[model samples]
Target: MIGYVTIGVSDMARAKAFYSDLLADLDARVLMDLDRIAFFGQSMGKPMLAVCTPYDKQPNHPGNGNMVAINPGSKELVDKLYHKAIELGATCDGEPGQRIPDRFYGAYIRDLDGNKVAFFHFG
Candidate 1:
């Protein structure tokens, strides 16, 4: 239905750092870069996540302000990614588990700038 989701960020450097590690943890690649950054996954068909600088001017900001979800290859990888995001300075919003009633197993995390990111594995 779509190609990529580009979100706003305050600092490009910080945003790059945050997403670089987060994407690598998912075994994703830095496919391209422009006014926005694009991250590619191992699976060729997966949609890339694009991040850009925020245009709006605001005194106070909120967490992540947005959400970008990625899928881990396995349940173990999901757990690893969930904990790793925290180790890398990301705040864990939700721990890796069944998000719904036996539905989604995922971990919701916020990046350095407070942007929400998630990792999941149905298995």
Candidate 2:
């Protein structure tokens, strides 16, 4: 099982700010803060999401098909989080909409460091 997910970032400060604002809507706050990484989540039991500089001391790169999916609690919250990510400079990968009528709704975006993130809700 996945305990947490980490995304590499070139600029720690920028990534921190981007996630700080974006995750606020989900009630995810800083759980751990270190010079090279920061973790965010609503609780320790929930999977944490982190941003960090590469441990290899090389330039950070996003994985081509990897992504972190976040549940924002409701269809409306999915829309809000997706838009908020855009407002914080994240690029849109998909607009908020139903993936399956009355079953799944979601949206996707690339974070400041170009890592894919999704916001979704199930009915």
Q: Please tell me which predicted candidate would have the highest TM-score against the true structure.
A: 2
lDDT per residue (tens digit) for residues 28-66 in model 2: 888889989999898888899989999989999999999
Root-mean-square deviation (CA) per prediction: 3.1, 1.0
Q: Find the candidate with the highest lDDT and give its number.
A: 2
What's the residue-level lDDT of 120 in candidate 2? 90
> For model 1, what is the C-alpha lDDT against the true structure?
0.71
lDDT of 1 by residue, 7-109 (tens): 6667767777767786786677666766544445555476777666655554225443457777776778888887878988889788888777666788888
Model 1: lDDT of residue 109:
83
- C-alpha RMSD between model 1 and the true structure: 3.1
Point out where model 2 deviates above 4 Å: none
Error of 2 at 115 (Å): 0.5
